[model samples]
Target: MRNQVLLIIVLLSALLGAPVATTAAEGISISETVLKMPLADDVSMDDAVDSMKLRANTLNFKLVAHLPLYKELEAMDIETNRIEIFQFCDARIANEMVIFNPDFSAYLPCRITLLEDADGKPWLVTLDLGKIIPSANLSPELLEKAKMVRDKIESIMQAGANGEL
Candidate 1:
């Protein structure tokens, strides 16, 4: 039978380390994370960071670090402006996540950057855990924790973008 013959071919190919056949070789993966949101029209870069910090504080995510990228660049004599990052964390949430998988530390103390483009409109950008969650193989409870943290992060970033909360 044709199906039997194909099965034999597939087994032999597997032994030879060949790729399995599929209808489309260019399938797009769902692991991609989309981040980056528009800032309030008339807001300045500093205002963006301020708004983000306020929102994070309201949610009990303590401020961890504030890195001024533009200033750091200037220290090396590179002329640039309107770029910095705000790092914060909720230890309880982070602890619950790590217990499920220590490898999740790579995403700890989440950060968001505030930057402006040529038009001087500020922007808030950060990575989405959903982008990395698929491969993380988290359990239902851990997945819920991840989503909870992710939701908080997105909410904070959006609040900062709107220059409110």
Candidate 2:
């Protein structure tokens, strides 16, 4: 049954001239699935996080939760670089998305992660919604909303990277 579904998808993609997301032997490309931005040398992690929070608020996205993962690991005596996650949501759009497709619930409340590389350079990362949303087969109206969400996320990332409030 799974093979049948896969065949059908391949046929459809061929007819449409769209590239299949993956093959039986291939994994998803990291470049296609993630968006990452590096912080400027002068911008501290605190400033970037503050800028992101301020941008989210300005865009009316609720800062739902924050997880200071590094602190927890530190408590466990695990030596690791700084890592934190911030979750944001627009409830109205999120609800509409779930109503349209239950699977979307799995992606609810978008997330951004902040981490420091081995060299101690800060970076912000998030899912590349631009690549995911087009495959969801959303209605035109919902598609616009989804794109808005993606844009807002990119905006927030930019603000954080630039340390712009």
Candidate 3:
């Protein structure tokens, strides 16, 4: 119920074009919950995906899955812009996170989405690790691992947006 309320608040903020504000207790802002990056105009979706995969590999993160949601929607005769999700994971870190708190498994195998908005502009979107990391009360080593994961994901997003490996 609490999570649902937070989601509603975030969605309202996005829809109303309100500036992101942090929740005093959690120290989490709407911006930190939803990170979005616009893709360069010159970059093709294929190139962007390739760049993301290459960057993930370089960072030792495995590409666990690719979900072409738009394709699925099309199969159902639904009209929608291109939308795809890529899941990546560092198994060792993920295992440790889960061991630390079983609830953390829900966040395992981090995902990034590639989609076209109403204006046909491409974007890369993901949940900011900051939303959870700061509140997780992690030990030093675990915190470092989590931060590394966050940094690597950000690097992947940048690579995709810039079409750079």
- Root-mean-square deviation per candidate: 12.5, 8.3, 3.8
Clashing residue pairs for model 3: none
Residue runs of model 3 more than 4 Å from their true location after superposition: 4-32
- 1-165 in candidate 3: lDDT tens per residue? 566567656644433334666658966677657778999989988999999999999999999999898899899999988888899999999999999988787676888888887778888888778677898999999999999999999999999999996
Model 1 agreement with the true structure over 78-108: per-residue lDDT tens digits: 8764677788898987897788767567567
C-alpha TM-scores of all predictions: 0.74, 0.84, 0.84
Q: How far is candidate 3 from the true structure (C-alpha RMSD, Å)?
A: 3.8
The runs of at least 3 residues in candidate 1 whose Cα sits more than 4 Å from the true structure, single-residue gaps closed, are 1-32
Prediction 2 global C-alpha lDDT: 0.81
Give the Cα error of residue 67 in candidate 3, in Å: 0.4
Candidate 2: deviation at residue 60, Å? Answer: 0.2
Residue-by-residue lDDT tens digits, candidate 2, 1-165: 543354345433322223556754754533446678999888899999999999999999999999898899899999978888899999999999999988787677888888887778788878778987888899999999999999999999999999997
How much does candidate 3 score in TM-score?
0.84
Clashes of each: 0, 0, 0
Number of colliding residue pairs in model 1:
0
Best by lDDT: 3
Q: Tell me which residue pairs clash in candidate 1.
A: none
